[model samples]
Target chain A: MSTSQGLRAWLLTEEPTSRRQARMAAWYKGWLTLRSNTLAMLGLMVLVVLLLAAIFAPLLATHDPFAQDLGQRLLAPGEGGHLLGTDSLGRDIYSRLLYGARISIYIVALVVMVAPVVGLIVGTVAGYAGGWIDVLLMRMTDIFLAFPRLILALAFVAALGAGIENAVLAISLTAWPPYARIARAETLTIRNSDYIHAIRLQGAGPLRIVTQHIWPLCISSLVIRVTLDMAGIILTAAGLGFLGLGAQPPSPEWGAMISEGRKYILDSWWVATIPGIAIFSISLAFNLLGDGLRDVLDPKEGQS
Target chain B: MSAIDIRNLTVWFGHGADRADAVRDVSFEVADGESFGLVGESGSGKSTILRAIAGLVPTWSGQMTVAGETLGPKRSKSFYRKVQMVFQDPYASLHPRHTVDRVLSEAMQLHGVRDIDTRIGRLLDDVGLGPGFRFRYPHQLSGGQRQRVAIARALACDPAIVLLDEPTSALDVSVQAEILNLLTDLRQEHKLTYVMVSHDLGVVGHLCERIGVMQEGRFVEVLSVEAMRRQQAEAPYTRHLLESSINSIR
Candidate 1:
């Protein structure tokens, strides 16, 4: 290489020593923690596979999930060109299971992303401001928390009419209260700290303090809660889909597939059983990931 | 013009019956480039006076000003740009998560001050820290180092007056001397005014030209450091406190 080219390459590769050190430390810590947690690794592996399968369902699926095959209805498992058998409607059970993962991803993403952002903003404002704002916001969160999750979701879906969007909305509405409570508690502790007082004295406004200091501290706990909530969110989505409150027929949803197969659960078995296992495994993986994250993020929280 | 002027400053907490005065009917003035200290024991309202000036103590009835401008109920950014405070506990005053760079940069950023890199480097150098310490987190710093960072942050806004609330009480005697010396040098170098609140006669003695001895939310005596050092306090309480403080050092 020319000297000028070599100099350019060297400049491009160079990083500040502190930044490089911090990144390496983080990367090594993550590697060490992941190596230690066998169950989490397995769970992560399962999630990766499910994610890829969902993404590549069009390519991975042996047959179309929606195509009716009445001529070959009730094909048993291990039958020629049919794997995990065909359903009562002669839809490919394996293909539906693969496609069902897409629905689960949507619900999980909404619950984990939307709920925390809204909750963090609301709770931090209430906690930092305190007094009447605290009372008003906390009371609203408490009222939402008083009802059981599924019942509130059911009420919301009932009121809004059935659809994937409405079910997500219902879940998101109910899910935020727990996060609000968590973020509020975290913000209260942070608001009273001496540094916060110092910054207030220096004329740092409420907006800067909340977004920079309060939000970052509260996020670790919020993330842990979100990870743990994923299982419930998936189940809630599945329940909504089963009750015809989420993605309706012609779309391959795990819960809807299970609901449709319930009549022939004993006759064909693969129809409902495969989708049931899919739900169970994904829920189990999310729980594992949540547990692992808590330990990795804060050792004390993990211990408690 | 006076750097800080407070007349009939009174502060209270809670409603009737539960209501208690923290600082009662206090008045003082520290002139431009002058260092005035309020010395008192715990619960003597000196800290409250300082907090009130910083706008931290919300319930107050007072007329206060900085650099000849009367302070309004709502403190403006312009007002903040004229006054800043250095807190007591260095460890707690510097944010645990923020780096020294962030801590100093924020003060400048708030006032829409540009040339952040040059300013940060200058402030760090003023605090006796080099450029390498900028990105290091507060946890990575020593107690004295953290206080220097806090001092740098306070100075970043180019405030005319600094309120020091027992700035050295949280440090060791040896480290305290270093911080005091740094404060003295910085005050001279920048021509900054100060209103420091402390219980230690020796501490305030190092910085103040005039020291107010306070007790139970009232000023027992407002005398020069030279008078305090010369055992010339007219009030019996001031004499007793000074005598005891002098005896303790031996």
Candidate 2:
């Protein structure tokens, strides 16, 4: 308790002794704002629980996720040793759900990593290096924006063949255009700012200006945007999985499990209903977190 | 030798259909250690000339020689090393995210200044700020404090010429006098040359030895502060400007 109190006092100090303290103070201030928001805190807690479930899936599962028994097919919830009952193939529903969390987290991780970086580079370059470069990159982004996200992803997945990696790749391609647009808009404004001109007068080159100066300003808004878009990315991944273009059969992916349970949906609702609830909760959690993050991270929303 | 020499400098904006010359065929020179001021009304292109000299505005045709080196389509790294600029708005000049130390250190490091930790402390002290101000972000500082940090950043490279674009215009009037006095002391201590652009003749008169009165993209006359004070100006526009400045002060 004393250590935490000391840390809080340090973070709230008006005079920081080092750069690290200042950075931590800023982050702590943001955390404080986020904590004040009850709904956002709830969403954060849900995501934390999801993450823990994904990490400890092996220890938490009652049975092997893939092990099958035709005799015990379609058991209801709280029956026998199974916690959430069994799926169509008698694979434990509770265990499959736990394993499925890992795949969902992996997809989110990959898409988050791949999409935003590609968008940031392309957007900052296009925005900072204007004229023909701007025209060229923006037109490319326009073309990407022209296509419906799912249809485009479907095309990429169909051509690349069905797999989780291909689904992530396809989603990343579709996801980047909006980030590029946001970054470009941000860059256009930031490039003309007095701070930028001040840096340029310091003998800093265009490369330095775009990478060091402009990117830092652009990243906060981009981060807010990325969080807001997380729901869509997850939904797109699930859509691909539902169509059998993601995390092939026997992988226990939530969407693919739902696809398998579609036949049993009329009688045994738990087979499909449970996984659908999982997807809904996760997506809703991201959306709530994104909204809260915008309140904290968006400079426009900040006090002058 | 002149610290800055400009020959037939013409700066414009937009393409053929919408071509508007912001500064046309303007020329001037400031000798070493001289403080020159440009004063005019809004949209009179006083700041445009300074932007052109700094190579911030690329759409200009001129011969700008700074610190004995001729400026071309691009300003060399040494040009930046020799010349630095303090912008008009302190609120907009410093990066919102960067701390005062980061702002000062980045400037010195860009020019390869060694022993940055000590230099930053000294720079802050030189600008009348304590070492405690080092780790605070721009938002944490007041307008006067931010302007002081901006001044410190400009002095980081020890440039021979410092361009002031209405440096204290955005500041409170009380803070303005403190900053102007600070600039005066910094100039004398460093033996620096200044090319300042401002609409407030009182400010220009306070810090500058010679004031150039401009009108509609043209220099009406370049008169010394003595000539301006004595009301012995050359152009009718100068007399009019002088009358207005005195009127505003009254």
Which candidate wins on lDDT?
2
lDDT over C-alpha atoms for residue A51 of model 1: 96
Off by over 4 Å in 2: A301-304
Interface RMSD (C-alpha) of each candidate? 5.5, 1.4
Give per-model CA RMSD.
4.4, 1.2
Residues B1-250, model 1: lDDT tens digits: 6778889888888889998998888888898999999999999999888888777878889798777778766777787788888999987787665667777778788877899989988988998988778776675677898899989988998988999999999999999999999999999999999999899999899999999888999888899999888999999999999889978988
Q: Model 1 RMSD to the real structure?
A: 4.4
Worst 10 residues of 1 chain B by lDDT: B94-103
Cα lDDT tens digits for candidate 1, A1-304: 6997864444333221354453343444555576589888788888999999989999999998889888777888868578888888787788878888988897788777788888998899999999999999999988977877667667876797777887888788888998998899888988987789878866788998999978877887888788788888898888888877777897888888888888987888888888889999999998998787776665223211
Model 1 chain A weakest 10-residue run by lDDT: A8-17
DockQ (C-alpha based) per candidate is 0.32, 0.75
Model 2: interface root-mean-square deviation in Å: 1.4
Task: Please report the interface RMSD of model 1 to 1 decimal.
Answer: 5.5
